[model samples]
Target: MPRRVAIIATGQTKHTARRLDVNIRELITEAVTRALQDADLTMRDIDAVLLGNMEPFEGFLFPELWAVEGWGGYMKPSVKFNTGGTVGTTTAIAAYYYVASGIYDVVMAVGFEKQSEGHTQTAITTVGDPIWERSVMAGAIGNFAVMATTYMHESGVTEEQAAKAAVKARRNACLNEYAHLQMPDITVEDVLRSEVLAYPVKRLDMCPQSDGAVAVIFAEESKAQRLAPRPAWIRAVATAHEQQYMGDSPKRLAEMRSLIAASRRAYQAAGITNPRKELDVAEIYEVASFAELAMYENLGFCDRGEGGKLIDMGVTELTGELPVNPSGGVMSTNPIGATALIRVAEAALQIMGKAGRRQVEGARMALATGYGGNAWTDVMILSQEKP
Candidate 1:
């Protein structure tokens, strides 16, 4: 049998459009230090260090080579990861595997990105296949806009419903200290009236590029008990990826095949029959408001095409039965490389009873997701009890 793993601590820096005061290396250190303090442990307690970042977004090559000290990986085994939008959670999942495999007792995963330091659009454009996807989708916004349109047509989800999701995210963000957007008074009207980025995807409907860092500590079952009063046990994790080109599947966003498969696999492994009622909270990488609606269907939070109805009913709100994105989600604070990892960290925080104002009351089981890299996805389940 595989050894059990649990998340002992999580740390995150204030997310903002810019972090001019500190370099990327310093930003990395801030989250790492906080994770160590949160766990009440030093570098000596960590067996290895793993980092996740979008190297192109920061215009840095071999970032880990120079920023080793930032992650406290000096003279210790270390690794780096970059999987587009999924980098953060991918890092956490990899660390979980390391500890659960019994090869390492404790591991730290860090996700960082300094979008202000480089041209995100240019860097993103460079990632395309240069021939196929470039013609089908202009860029990230264009890609999602097309996806949102498909969902709108298929599900009959109205613009009002998407705005409601934006309203919920921004309002919830006000209660989170590390979130980038803090629009406490934002309303559906505000989202509807906001500038349109691409068709149905309005300014508020989309997530902003921000600079931030997040870190989480994973430990073996025995070490987790001593590291934190309440450890968030890893229940199950799954990853799925679609074909690299959008031309291969134009209905990618509407179908969300990767998310559907990954989430189902995770649910099966976690022994969850009904996700809508069984899971307490979710921290999904909802890159856009419409994407969140689509996710509701794909994640089985609601029947297909009923996502609009679910949001309208406020089923995923903070006080809802199964509150989702109580940490404001990706729409509220997105640091690209660190965005998906924030989902894991926030979910773990909920299980640890340290989510403070954004705490899902009495949360026991949480679902976290990461979505990026040609429509790939990673889903993880965290439980308050050993799984």
Candidate 2:
């Protein structure tokens, strides 16, 4: 059997619209530096370095060659993953498996994106189904718009409910210093009134493209305590994917098959029969407001079609029964490449008691997820207790 592993430290650069001051390498270095300091380690202490990002988004090919010295991968085995938006979760899982398998004692995983420097929508456009690429979708906005509208029809969720979710995310982001967008006084009405980007998805409902990076140190079980006083144990991880075509499922948004599969298996592995009561906090990937609501139903936080009700009841509020996306979430800050890793980093920070004003008090268990526009999902469970 493989040895246990845990996240000893995590760090992230403040996310924002543009960072013309620093190059991509420097941006990655910023996050890596903070992670190293948090772990109290130097390059000599790291066994291997793993990195990931959507190269198309930044128009870079073979990124490890470009940012070798940036993430301290000098003379170290460097592996890069280009799994689109799920890159972060896939990279972190690789690090965990390496440590758990005894191939490495300590590993660093970095996820970064400089979205301002590229045309993400255009890049995303090139990766869609060739059959319906031109006629059906214009990129993520058009695809998600269809999903959101269909979900509304089948689940009885309203634009008002999605607007509430948007309000919750941005308002919660006000406490996170690294969040890209902070709308402290944003209200549901403001979301409803904002200019619609594509149907129900308003400017306020969608995530902003940002330039940011996030890094975390994963260690073998024995080295975990030495690395940090409190480590976030990797309790369980699960992933699921759907067909490549976006039109594979008509009710894709209303009933996310990949998310449902991933969350169920991950929860089972973590021995969580009641997620809402068992997990303390959740940092899910919601590119838009409606996605979160859809996730609420698929993740078993509530019954099907009750996502709207869940938001209206404030169940996922900052101080509510179970807080979701206390780090502002993708709805407020989405650096596609790093967004998934940001979710994991925030969850680990909560477990380590290192989260600043946005920390969930006495948080012992947390859940994080990664969503890919390519029809895939990754779910990871972290806890204060050893698995």
Candidate 3:
């Protein structure tokens, strides 16, 4: 017997470099209130809460316990999970389980990151062990740069091909109302000529730190029918964790073994054969231009090492075969811990036809993927109709 879970409500705050307008409680309230309105329900309708966050980034040990009340959890059952960048998607899966397992009728899944309030780079640097790896690794961008070099060397991808992805993302970001980075008139030549941050990775090639919050309501099938006219249902979800050390495997090992394996299980469970043909839209976690190209191969859109070809041919653009990261993706609006769940939420919004100007045309099926912590991975398949 399979249980059914659907997202009946979705809400988000404006993504910005710094949010001095509201406190944490106010930010939480803004998203939750909007979700309730979208579901045509009230706070009283929620049965539990699941929060996703990376505490170290905010220098707070247990912000979830204190912020639960603001998320409308109050005395209700509430808990938070931290899994590097996978926290958001991981939290959403937990909320869905709470509903599908008959433990809760409605669960509020929320993820937020106020990078402006904390030292994000220092927090990210701590992901690697301080004994050896931390001293050598510059940080996320540095690690990504090394990986990008490997990708270029292996796949024979030109720097200009990867630069195109950056231009497309910033262009898409301009259409995203909640997006903080908007470069409507950007071009590949512009990214190629931008200031280099970490060799292959340029200042313009990387995503910006953002302060934002996103909330969605997960309801049992019966409750979903009463909440919204149409709901984006969760068909299949899978999570896989890899070794913690960066040197444990080859440079691109995580992309193939951890990320791709989880996606295979998710796609198989969702009855998908060809992702390029089956998925109408996708929101992937690609913090850099090369990562997006690598994702095209990892997600089965193309063969291994052919990801660069996909970008060069303009296959990932909004009007391409499969519209990817139409909401500008993590590359355009990264909120770190909230990024994975933002992918999930953005995909759901596309399926619900609520993505505004960034929405894909006639999108019926969508996918969202999360990758972080060197080895941790989570892939989720969502649809306008159930599997």
Candidate 4:
């Protein structure tokens, strides 16, 4: 069995539509510097560095080679991941293994994306099967629009319910200093009136392309205890992937097979028989408003098609039975590559009792998830107590 590993520190840059003030390298350095400071350690203390980003989105290949100095990986062992949106959490899991295997004492994982520097939609169009789905694909919005329509037809989920989710996410972003969209006064009415991007999906209902970076430090039990007053222990991790072709699963978004499988495995490994009751908070990757509701069911927070009811009952509010996306989630700040890692970082902050204004009172356990490429899911559980 792998040894215990804990998150010692986490840091993120202020997310925005465009970060013209700094280049990609500087953007990465900002997050890395803050993480090292938060851990009360220097570059010399990091045994290895792991980084990830959606290279196509940034029009760059082999980014780590030129950006190494910015993340302090000049002479340390380093690896990079480029898995579409799940790159962030994938990189974090890699760091966890590095420490858990007893090969490294301290590891830093970083994920970033400068979407403004490249053609995001054009890049995303290439994700589909080149010979089969590429020509007809209209990027993520078109794909999600179809999914949203299917969900509404089968589950009676109205556009208003999705609007409520959009309002909740942007409102929550008001309390987060680093969030890109801080709409404290946003309402369901405003979301309903927003320009329709794709049928059943409005402009406010989708996540924006953002520029940002996130860095996190993982350490073995002994070093973690010495570094952080309250370390977020990694209790369990699970990942699942399915056939890449969208046509392979016609009801893909509604079923979300990968998310269900990954969450089930993670819950079993964490000894969580009842996730809604056992997990204190969750920071799920909700790329679109409707996706959040779908996740509530797939993650076993509620029965299928009952996601809308959870939001209506305030069950997932900041002060409810389980708070979801208190950091505003991907809806408020989606840097694609860093978005998933941000979910993990936010969960760790809650477990460490370091989440400011948006903190969940006395949170002891938290769940985070990563979704990508229409069929991949990554689930991680963190807790204040050792597992």
Q: What is the C-alpha lDDT of each candidate?
A: 0.91, 0.91, 0.84, 0.91
- Model 2 lowest lDDT segment of ten: 242-251
After superposition, candidate 3 runs with Cα above 4 Å error? 248-250, 253-255
Task: Tell me the tens digit of each residue's lDDT in model 1 across 1-387.
Answer: 779999999999999999999998899999999999999999898999998999988788778988888878888888899999999889989998999888999999999999999988778877788865665555588777877888899999999999999989989999899999989899899999999988988999988889999999999998999879999999999999877766644466668989999999999999999999999999999988998998999999999899999999999999998888998998999899899999999999999999999999999999999999547999999999899
Runs of candidate 4 with Cα error greater than 4 angstroms are: none
In candidate 2 the C-alpha lDDT for residue 343 amounts to 92
What would the TM-scores of all predictions be? 0.98, 0.98, 0.97, 0.99
Question: Clashing pairs in model 4?
Answer: none
| C-alpha lDDT of candidate 2 relative to the true structure | 0.91
Q: lDDT score, residue 205, model 2? A: 86
Measured by lDDT, the strongest candidate is 4
* Per-residue lDDT value at 303 in model 3: 88
List, residue by residue over 1-387, the lDDT tens digit for candidate 3.
557999888888888888899877687788788888888888888899888888888886687776766678778899888888788899888988899898799998988888898998878888878898888775687877777777788777778888888888889988888887889999888898999998888988889999988898999998887777778999899988766656633367225568888999999999999999999998988888888888888889988878878987878889899988998888788777678888888898898888899989899889998887557778888999865
Candidate 4 per-residue lDDT, tens place, 113-136, comes to 999999999999888878878898
In model 2, which runs have C-alpha deviations exceeding 4 angstroms? Answer: none
Best by TM-score: 4
Worst 10 residues of 3 by lDDT: 247-256
